[model samples]
Structure formats: structure tokens, C-alpha cells
Target: MESSSHQDSVDSTPVSYESSQHSQLSPSYPRAQTTSLSLSSTPVNDQAHNGYSSPATSVSPQPEEPFKAPSPAVTRKKLSGYVGFANLPNQVHRKSVRKGFQFTAMVVGESGLGKSTLINTLFSTTIKPQRLYSQPGSELPSTVSVESTSADIEENGVRLRLTVVDTPGFGDYVNNDESWKPIVDNIEARFDAYLEQENRVNRQKMVDNRVHACLYFLQPTGHSLKPIDIEFMRRLHQKVNLIPIIAKSDTMTDEEILVFKQRVLRDINYHQIQIFSAPIYDNEDEETLGENEAIASKIPFAVVGSTSLVQSAITGQEIRGRSYPWGVVEVDNEDHCDFVKLRQMLIRTHMEDLRERTNLVLYERYRTEKLLGMGVAQDPTVFKEINPAAKMAEERTLHEAKLSKMEAEMKMVFQQKVQEKEAKLKQSEEELYARHKEMKDALEKQRLELEEKKRRVESGRPLTPDRPSVGQQQSQKKRFGLGK
Candidate 1:
């Protein structure tokens, strides 16, 4: 039964079961018949002579296909529960409030411009140190002196570190040629301080002492910006945000102030002086934009600064203003003066903006110039993550421009060289022609002389007159030799 099963398995393909059984049972069998009768299902193995081959007759490996990345899904996910991340702004607000804020302002003007009083009224804090009034004959300060006052004011759980820098005796000297130097030096010193602190290895206790805004108090002369004012603004405009103010506005009449403001604005525009204008952002609402515009329109603010409160006769209420024989000039009243707008800009509206501009724009510009002057080089493409395509486009345009410039320069050089070579060749050709003409003239002269000589010889004519022979001369001279 086992042998029959084996025969059946062996002869599954070709040989019959009877032939397989006969071959297996026979002790001696013909090799050809046995080999021909045997049926195998396994593949045949062939031996190769020289090269590598598989044990099987016909086999080849198929190349594996490269792997491909799966495409990302472009579907929006729906939240199953509230993540509570909408409170990020509130979180930022709380953190900012807790950290508090610091702002430094600089007041630059002549003496008696009410700079200190304006500062006090703006922040509603006594940051300026009280100074005693000098007698009529007191000697004036020889030079401008810088004074600083600082205070910590808190209101509604918000703390503010306010600093006020005052410049006294500015424009007070008879010869104020370089009067703005001290102020400029002070501002630069503050910048240096901040830069030094930044360059330090440890910066935990870095203090920002740089000035943010400069309040330039112009004298209320009912005219235009004085030489000192113009020069000072020109020197310091790029350093700090300038806020020009018309001090002692009560002294000027309404029409006079209006004309003066126009004149001042014209002068500023003509000189290309930049003043601190309120920035209107894209996200601002109409009301805010309107307010900003209003504030901006009131530049060179004609202001009356008074830290005292007085009762208004018209309204019969307590207000911050100056009482005079004619009427009360309200400080906070927009109709009376622009103190309210100035205060609003200095403290209420754009205090943070002032600081931000000082730190970001002015300081960064100064830092860049300073670093470059110090032989420091920086790659301009370090922080270009925002709008990479636009940056690339800009760079490509610049590169093309550079390449075009180089090509133009090379073409010009090549043209110049060609022209020089042509000029040299022309000059050499003229020289060669002159030389050839000279040689030809010389050769013609020689040929003419030789031809004349040949003609003289061919004509059988003596080249010179015939002369007597020595023997004939002696024989002929024998007759005449007795005399000599």
C-alpha cells in the first residue's frame, strides 16, 4: 500500500503508476528507460561554466518599486470639547499688567517753557522736582544742564515707572552754536548704556534707560520755529520721537496761534523734519481712527500747562485752567487749548507706542549704524521666515539687476578695449605708411643718382674733367721747373 502510494506520488505528472512500480521493483533496469520513466515535479538544476547562475533553469529577480509617501489629508477637524484657548489675549493682558511698564520721556526747551508743569499734568504725578524761583538778578546757567526725575505711579492695579528728563538753559546762552550737543550726547549716552547692557553675558537685570519721546516746547512768540528749535529738532529727530508743543499758549490770541501753527508746520515740512504722529493701525475702528486723526491734526499743540485747578466762571465748576482778567483758559478744554490732546497722546493713547518705536525703530537703526561703524558685518537674510516667497522674489530681482549691471560694465570695458586697440592699429598703420614712403623716397633718390652716373658712363664722358699724367706733367714742367 505504501509502495502504491509512493508510485502514485512519483508518477503524478507523466509516467504511469505501473511503470513506476516496475522500475522500483526491478533490481537491474535500463538507465535510459528508468531516466525517461522517472517523473519529477521539482525544477531542473543546470551547472554553469564561468559565470554565476541560479540552481534552477529559468529564474530572475524582479526589481522592487520605490516607496511613496502618503498624501496629507486636507480636512478640517471638529473639536469634540472646548479647549479654552480663546483666553490667550486675556492671559497676555494679565501677564503684561503683572509685569508693569516703564516709559522715559525727554523735555527739551528754553527756560520758562513750563516743561516740568506739562509733565506733571500729563501723568498726574509729581515726577519733576520742585525748583525755587530765582531772584530777578540771579545769574543764568552758562550751559544746558540735564536733570532726571523718576517715579512709580499705580492706578487701578497697574504700576508705571515714569521717568522725565529735563534740559535746562537750552538756547539761553548768547552764542548757542553747539547748544544741542549736550542733549545729543545725553541721548547717545543712554543708547550706549542700553547697548552695553545688552552685550553683557548676563542680562537679567538690564535696565532700559533710553529716551522714548522728546517734548520740544517752542516759545509762544506768535511766529514760527526759532533757529534753536529748528536746529535742535534737526539734530535729534532721528534719535527720538519729537512732539513739538507751543508753550504759554494763553499769551497768544486765537488768530495768532492759528497762523503760527500753520507757519510752524510749513517750516517743518520744508525742512523735512519728522514729528511724532499718532499711528492708525488697520485693526483700529472708525472712532479710534477719527480720534487719532484729530490728535494728529493738532500737532505742535498750542497748550497751556497748569498743575493747578481753577473754577470756571462760565461753567461755574472746578476745572484745570488759568484764570485771567479776560477769561479762564481751560487746560483740558479742546476749545481753549490742546493740552488735552497732548496729554492723551503722552499718556492715554500712545505711551506704549512711543516706547515701542524707540526700542524697535530708532534704537534698531542706531544699533545697526553703530555695529557697522565698528566693523561688524551681519547677514541680511538671517530672520526671513516671514514672506519667504516675497523675499526670494526680491532677492532674485536684485540678483538680476546686479548681473545686468556687471554685464553692462563688462561690455563697456570690452568696447573700450576694442576702441583702444583700433586706435593703436590706426596709429601704427599711419607710422608704417610714413616709413614706407620715406624708404621709397630715399630709394628713388639713390636710383636717380645711379641712373645719372650710368648715363654719364654709357655716354663715354669723363665723370670729372681730364687731368695731366705725372710723367707728362714732369716732362712738361721740366721746361718750367727751373723757375720754381
Candidate 2:
């Protein structure tokens, strides 16, 4: 019996193992399949085929259940390796360097204000040719002419495509009422061109011809801004970044330059004109912030531009400046003028910022207005992002609306049910009243008839006229069968 029991246990082990395996492999199969697998499978078939009998001591049932493979959709896989995307800034810098950059600056001033000399000296190269002093009796231009000059300049392997737009004879004419018209028109034309390019179906090659910065040269006179200068700045302040500079500052004394800068800034503020101020970023270090502040403090920069290299009498060193009867005025000298600060802000620091502002703020405002004027509307929700608080508020409003509607419907249904029940109750009450009245009338009639019969009997009157009297019973009996 012991051997038999052990043998039965060993034989059943493989059957149970196979059934469990099948169940784990296919958990979706019906229970009948599991029962059949356990009942039909036999380990004896394998033992007979191999001509081997199971050793009782070696046979044992599994102690653990079968493992089920998880569903593919819910299974999570761990990453085995790392991919590098931290070099994105390097990639963008490389791409920008390869593509090069373009910047267009507009210069507006009257003739003989050293606009050409300033441009040549600012770039440290001959961008504009040096002009000779106008000879007497020479004809002056009657109208302002828009002229552009471009140069590809490189420094330390970095290339810059600089374009300077010079407005000749801006304030030279006597009738300068509409002097700012051409400049405004040119700026608008550039904006229109950019807008047209954006609306095109294929924009593979986009040329940025828009003016990023406008350098307005104020004459170095000790007085305030002229009417033409005020009008020009007013017209173009919203359209471009305005940077005011006191041109030919060498002619003005130190005290005159200081007082002139104050008066110019005061007039600008009074007229509500916006000048380009260096933007301070939150992430900038203290040193950088200080540098930017120093640059901005020298607004309406007092600049003296000179392309000629002259020997300084004090240091005997050659510098780009002009010779005066008193002494040499070095162009790069901070004590002499603010040319270093101007160059630093215009080229070294804020070039890209100027471009960014022109494209994002100034151009965007113009584009929005233009599109609206053309009767094109934009959906306000297009620029909105999904915020959890706002979304929850909106969802709560909708849910409240739904709940209020449901409550109103329920109230209406309950009222209708109550009205119907009231009507039915009223009808049943009326029917019961009518039935009670009819029964009362019948009972009253029966009582009246009984009273009349009692009255007749008491008064000794016959109840019916055809019936015999009670005293004539003998005559009645003789006349009927009662006599027999």
C-alpha cells in the first residue's frame, strides 16, 4: 500500500505540472481544458517509452506555482544605455556660426554732421569713404535720398554682415515739414516685405531686410533737440530701436556735453519717446549687470568719430582721433567721449538683442495690426497652455451646470407626479361623496315607508285596500281550503 501510494503521487505530479504550465501559458482558456489536461495526461507513457521506472524517493510534487507572463501593454522595460542630448547648445552655436549673421542699421542726420566719418570709425574700417569739405557755391541735395552700403567683416574668425542705411539731406531742406516721411516709408516697406515672406507657401529662403536699429545723430550744439529730430524719433520709435548719439562731440566742451545729454534726455522723456535701453536678464552675474548698467548710464552717447590715426602729444602713442589747437582728442578715450561704450553696446553686447526685439516685439505688433486691419481674426485660445487650476475651474463650472439642469428636471418631474396624484385623489373623493349621497337617499326612503306602515297599524287602518281585515278571519276561512 505504501508503494502504491508513492507511485500514485509520483504519477500525478507531472500531470499537475503540465496542467499548471498550460494554465499559466494561456490564462484565457476555459476551466474544462485544465481539468482535461490533468485527467488525460499520463507520465507512464514517457516511462514506458524510455523503458524506465520512477524511483519512489526521487519523485516529488512541485512546491511552487507556475509563473505567468505579464501582458505586453502593461510591461515596463528599463533602459540599458545612455543617449547624449546635453550637447544641444553646442550644436546650436555651431549652426549659427556656420550660417553667419546679418544686421541692418539705419543712420539719420543732416548733412555735414560727420555721419560718414562716424560710420567708418565705428567699424574700425573704411565702410564709407571720407568726404571732403563742401566747396562754396556747391549745390545741396533738395530731398533726402536713401542709400545703403554693406560689408562682410570678420574678427577672430567670426563673420558679420553689416549693412548701414544712410539718409542724406534729412534735415538740410528749408521745408522739412515732411522730412521724416521717406524714412518712415522705408521702414514700413521693410516690414511689409518680411510680412509677405512669412505668408508665402514656400519659405525656404527668407531674407531679413528689416531695420533692427536706428542711430539718430543729434548735432553737438548746446541747445535741445530740433523739431525735425523730435518728429523723426516720434514717428520711428515704435517701428525700430532708437539709439540717440551726440555727433561731432569734439566741438562741444566737457560741461556742454554733460548739460546737452541731460537736456536731450529730458526732452525725450517729455515727448514720451522710447529709446533702446539695454535689457537686464535675471540670470546675469553681478559683473555683467554692472557692465550693462555702465553702458546704459552713458545714453545719448557723446561720440567723436575719426578714421585718421594721429600721434598723441601726451603719450606719443598713435590713436584714431582729431588734432585740435589745444590738444589731441582721442576717439577711443572715455574721458574725451563715450565712443567705447557706444561700440560695446552696439556691436559687442546688444547686437543680437536688438534683432530679437525687432523681430518679436516691434514686428509682431505691426503684423498683428496689419492682419486685423485686413479683417483676419485669430482665436485667443491658440496661445493658451493647459493649466491644472484653470482646467479644474472650467470643469467644475460645467459639472455645476449639468447638476443644476438635472436638479431642475427632477423638480419638474416630481411636481408633475404630485399634480397627477392630487388630481386622482380629488376625483376619488368626489366619486365617494356621490355614492354616499345615493345610499343615504335610499335608506331615508326605506325608513319613511316603515314609519308609514307602523302609523297605519297603530291607527287601526288597513295597510292595503284589497286585503281582509283581522276580525273577519272566520269568513276568510270558510271561503278557502282552511274550512276543510
Candidate 3:
């Protein structure tokens, strides 16, 4: 069985880590994405595989004083780019609680699926999105995936100091998205430093200061949670608190909405997930349609207009605008709802319960045959078999070794991912160069044609801006009295 601490680390990926919506789905979420101690990717079928995470080294770049600005470092080294999560504070060890809590989250999804737009809309930040492309010839996805974004956001009486994570677009490229294995592989390739054993839990920073919850922003649509979403939620199941949100609920209908709910809940049951969703108001206007030919071509639809219908039923008097019958009054004027209640349920109610469960059931409880997957917290006597001091020392060593190995393995894994990305970027650069060359060549051909016309004009030969067929050219010359 995996250790609890590692589970804790993985769970934190959303709060401090994140995921959300899109129209695409992958056949499987990558094995590397799962929070495990081992880092190697060459796994046999029998051995369990989650996705992979690269190693992370603490970076404390000293900021220059106000008078002096800093220079960005340029290196021809392996690119283990850290997406989603924010940097650890400089004096994190020194606990001086400040004003306003840092509420972090990672945004993930396909390239054009509004992941970045959602972040900008939510936090009101001006984040320039990077273009995501595909790999050449092999028909595979671009190695430079739309990974998690590492950014802070704030808005609307909600000073949510958040980290919007941007992930690689799943089905953006041409590779058969047989459940998008490569996309998940990229997530599994994120930095995995907390789960390392020898790595002493920065109990303060990690346990108390890590991610509080994960908000999975699903795009509003008629389609339900695709297999890819199921795989994603399943993998991140134990790692963090998940709040499933519908981004654009306007496109769904009464029947489709019911199906989407039933399907998601069914998947939740199948996974045996206890701590689950608290519904939030649909943030986007469902009526807003996409302009892209690919998206605009789909059937135009509207959200179920029951707001007024429900409102009339409630007040004994005829009401106008949106309403519902289930007493699901979205009290906050067309805009806000009781997210406070939902927030409490997410960050408070089930929090301590899950925390305890994670530590007791998932963490302290060992399941290596000795306990046979039973709860290990039942008896205190289990600790008696080994010497207290020696056991502590051994545990520390093992933990350290686990940490070191995890570091080395994660570093290697993410580096491979980075190299894959760099190679992709290099290829894209080459393609762009070729495209520029082609455009230049075409422009030259057009230029030569114009030059020939100018030369004819100077020599008193028949000339015109447009090229004409033989019959038309002769007719024009005859009309102009130019046929000698």
C-alpha cells in the first residue's frame, strides 16, 4: 500500500494543484500522474503505474533590493518547467501569519477550450497563452503540452490568492485520443518532491499550508463526463478535495443535464468516493457561442429556462426571469450563489474528516500483508515489535531514501518531458522558418510577374495589371489600338 503522506502530497496538487474541463477525453489517465514513491517509467504490466512526476529542487533566487532589478537566467540545460503550483515562500519556516489567505488552484484543459479564458475571467489577470502545437510526421501530440499554469488570481470581493494551472490540450493534436494516454503521462510527469520519504514532511508548509481543495471546472456542454474525466477523477481521487463544477451549463438541456448528473454520480459510486461535490452556479453565459468554424458548426442550444417558472411557483405571484421548482433559489442576483456554504462543506466539514482518514486510514495504516489491508490505527501495540529509537531512525532513513529516489526519478521523468517539449519547440521553429521561406518564395514569384508588366509598359509593349488569356489580351489590344 502507498503511504499516507504521499497521498497527502498528491491530494494537495489541486488546491495547490488543479484540473478542470474540455470537450475531449483520453482512454486512460497516465499512470505517472498517480502519487507513488517510485519514479521509473519502464513498468511491466503487473506493476501498478500512475503517471510520472519529475524531481523538484527548492529554488531560492534572492531578490535584489528595490534599486536593483534581477536578470533572468539563461541556460542550455534540461527544462523541468514547473507549472500549476506556486513557489515556496522564502522564509516559509518562519511562521508569521499574514493578512489574506493564499487560495491556490491549477487550471488544466485543451488549448482553445477556455482554460486560460476562465482563469482571466475568474481572476481578471492578463495572462498571455502560449500556442500549443503537434509533433511532426509521427502524428503524435506536440511534446510541449498545455501543462498546468503557475499563476496568482484575484476578483469580485474574493481575494482568492490562486494558482491557475494550465495543462496540455488532450485531443488538440491528431494522435488517436484512445483515452489520451500521453496527456496524462505529462501530468504524471509534474514535479514530485513532497512524496519523497527521506524528505521530512515540512509539516508546516506541506501539511498545514498545502492545497485546501481542487475545483474541477468542466466546460458547459451537452456531453457528459467523458472516459478521460472519469480516469482523471479516479487517479486524483485520494490526493485532494474535489469540487466538480460545470463551466458552461447553458448548453445542456433538462434531459441531458439529468443524464450528466446521473453518470457523474455513478462514476463517483463506482470509485467509492465519499467526500465529493458541492454544486456551484454556472459561471459562464450558456448563450455565448463559439465563432470557430469547427465549434460554431455544432447545433446551437440554450440552458433550460426554468428560472422564471420556478420563481412564479415560489411567490404565489407571477415572477419574471429565471426560476426553479426544487427550492433551488440562487439567492444571489443572477450572479452569485451561496458558494460560502459550498466552500464550508469543501474546506471545512469534510476537511478534518478526510485529513484524519488520510493520516489514519491512508497514512499511518500500513497494508503490506501484516495488516492485510485492514485499518492499522486500531491497535497501538503494533509499534512494540521494533525498538522505538532504532525504528524512528530506520523510518527516517527509509523516508529520506524514498525522498531521494523520488527526487532523482521525478527529475529524470520531468526532464524527459521537458526535453520532449524542447524538441517540439525546436521542430515548430523549423516549420515556421519553412513557412516563412514559402511565403517569401510566393511573394517573389508575384513580384517577378509585376516587374515583367512594368518592363512591357516602358518598352511600349501591351501591359496590364492582370494577366489575360490569349483571346482577351488580343481583344484588349485591338480596342486600345495597340495591335501593331
For 363-450, candidate 3 gives per-residue lDDT tens digits of 2322222234454334443423344666688789999999999999999999999999999999999999999999999999999999
Worst 10 residues of 1 by lDDT: 26-35
Cα lDDT over the full model 1: 0.72
Q: What TM-score would each prediction reach against the true structure?
A: 0.63, 0.62, 0.36
Per-model CA lDDT versus the true structure:
0.72, 0.72, 0.41
- Candidates ranked, most accurate by lDDT first: 2, 1, 3
lDDT by residue (1-484, candidate 1, tens digit) is 0111211012211111111101111000000000001112333333332242222222223346633445668998899999989899889878978887777888888778888888777655456755666799998677777777666766655666666787777887889998999889888888887888888898877677788889999888765567777788889988898888899999998877776676667567656676777765668899988987787778779898776789999889887788899889888789989987887777777777787778776787788788889999854543223355666898999999999999999999999999999999999999999999999999999999999989999999988889999887888878887424
TM-score winner between 1 and 2, please give it: 1
User: After aligning candidate 3 to the native by TM-score, how far in Å is the CA of 33 from where it should be?
Assistant: 22
Candidate 1 colliding pairs: none
Model 1 segments beyond 4 Å from truth? 1-81, 136-139, 381-484
- Measured on C-alpha atoms, candidate 3 has an lDDT of 0.41
Q: Pick the candidate with the highest TM-score.
A: 1
After superposition, the stretches of candidate 2 with alpha carbons farther than 4 Å from their true spots are 1-86, 131-140, 379-484
What does candidate 2's lDDT look like per residue over 1-484, in tens digits?
Answer: 0111211011211111011101111000010000000111122111211232222122223335433434448677767777567688779877877777778888899888888888777777766665555789998666776777667765544556667788877888778988888788888888888898888898877778788889999988766677777788989988888999999888989877776776666557656677888776668899988987787778888899888889999899887889989999998889999988888788777778788888877887788788889999954333333455666887899999999999999999999999999999999999999999999999999999999999999999989887668658877888786865
